[model samples]
Target: MYSRFFSLMGGLAAILSVSGGFGLSDVHAAPRDRDDVFFRSVAGVWKGPGEIVAGKYKGTKFTCDLTGEPLDDKQTGIKLGGTCRVGVFSQPMSAVISQKGNSYEGKFLDGAGGKGLDITSGQVSGDKVVVGINRAKLNGAMVARVSNDNSMNITISVKVADQMIPVIGVTLARDIDQIAVGSIKP
Candidate 1:
């Protein structure tokens, strides 16, 4: 089950790359946002169960975790090419990370069949962190945000690909005011 999921993620990364997210011109570039370090520090290993919460997949749940390193060097097309793997999987899936201007993008091979999973587009402003994904199939916004050290939130806006309607929306919010991170592994 694990292999199947990660393999799909890997293939997705490849497709996203081919789709012009990180072309040859962007295969290598310096990390722009300084928050990359902060994000990386909190990125280690995290695992938690999450429910679909909204949309056709609503109520569906999965145990997910994400693990990755900070891309401080000027490298793209999978960052370390073999070292950086983040997401819920036993084996580190191939992740392509690149930075352009003040924003950073990551493409992951969501698994074998060349279908992408959770492609991320995010930016950092001051102590606030905001990230989002526009799924091709789902056709909605999956977004999340975090404050310097006291707050974090995630939201999923349901988008129907077939009819182009938003059926549902879900949001998860927590204040670092209490628990440790209070975050579900992405």
Candidate 2:
């Protein structure tokens, strides 16, 4: 049961990686100014409701609270920490993301007593970001698009057997008060 929970958390993190507005790519290069601006623009607290759209957990609903903080002054990276709740179950999650040139890389910690999830590749454009994930038994991609400064939509898909299935979809809104006054620690 715990393992399943971790998998769920990992999937959620993948979704957050995209929804959080961080970009990823496969190249090693210097960071770009526009990427920095994009990350900074989305840095803050976000809260929303999400639903599992496929797989075993399909139809399960959850609420998420996530916080995005700059890892450095240059805005080259961001740290994400938060929790998601489904009925009586609550899971904590975190990620450390860094941008170089037009590419992005990051490590996702599901807070489920495991190493972490590796974000192998990703890219950012205008108000959107996409990231690829590689895990022991699961592989997929997450895509996010910001509709405005305050709202965004995220979709997470996982490769099951030989087919890609969309597993989660969420719509998030920036919490201005939480961002300005700071959020409660998870």
Candidate 3:
């Protein structure tokens, strides 16, 4: 469960990398307005439950507590750090992403070389981000969708032969808010 979920997440394994948003080449120039805004919107503390929906780890459920921070305003990207807990075990997780040229580059944990995956490339379209991930002989994709300012859903999938299979699914909600607002009365 840990290996697969982390591998899947070790994920942002690409999504977070894409969100933390990083680049292989030297990041130059400025990012698009939407890109800038996207990263900023994801900046905050997030927590939620996740499940390994497929493979041998099917039915495995866990939870993660993560915090996201937007990069410098000049750059379009984000960085995420936190821990994922499963039963009595816990793992430290981190991801970084940046925009280089027209694409994005980043990595999860220490990248594919260590215990996490690498963010090869990514693109942000409206409320969601799709990132390419790779680790040794395995190749996959992570998609993160921001349903609203306070919610996000992440899905991680690996390429099997000629198919992309979903392996992990996570739903995150912001845990902290700068200010509380009054509700409207009907």
Best by TM-score: 3
Per-residue lDDT of 46-89 in model 2, one digit per residue for the tens?
Answer: 88888888866778888888888766876476778888788888
Residue 96 Cα positional deviation in candidate 3, in Å, after optimal superposition: 0.3
Misplaced by over 4 Å in model 2 are 2-6, 14-31, 100-102, 110-115, 160-163, 181-186
Clashing pairs in 2: 24-104, 24-122, 24-123, 25-104, 25-122, 30-101, 31-101
lDDT of 1 by residue, 1-186 (tens): 344333333423222212211111222334442344444433333333344443444454443333334455554222312221323334444565555556556555541124444545655444333333443544333333442232233344434544434322222222223334546777
Tell me each candidate's TM-score. Answer: 0.49, 0.79, 0.83
Off by over 4 Å in 1: 1-33, 75-95, 110-113, 117-120, 126-128, 135-138, 147-153, 158-186
Q: Residues 1-186, candidate 3: write the lDDT tens digits.
A: 367566566675335323422221223424476677667766667778888889887888888888778888788888888888878888888888888888888888888888888889888875678988899998988888766666678888889999999988888777756434688986
10 residues in a row with least lDDT, candidate 1: 16-25
Q: Let me know the TM-score candidate 2 reaches against the reference structure.
A: 0.79
Per-residue error (Å), model 3, residue 37: 1.1
Ranking 2 against 3 by lDDT, winner: 3
Between the candidate structures 1 and 3, which one is better when assessed by lDDT?
3
Write down the RMSD of all candidates, one decimal each.
10.8, 5.9, 6.5
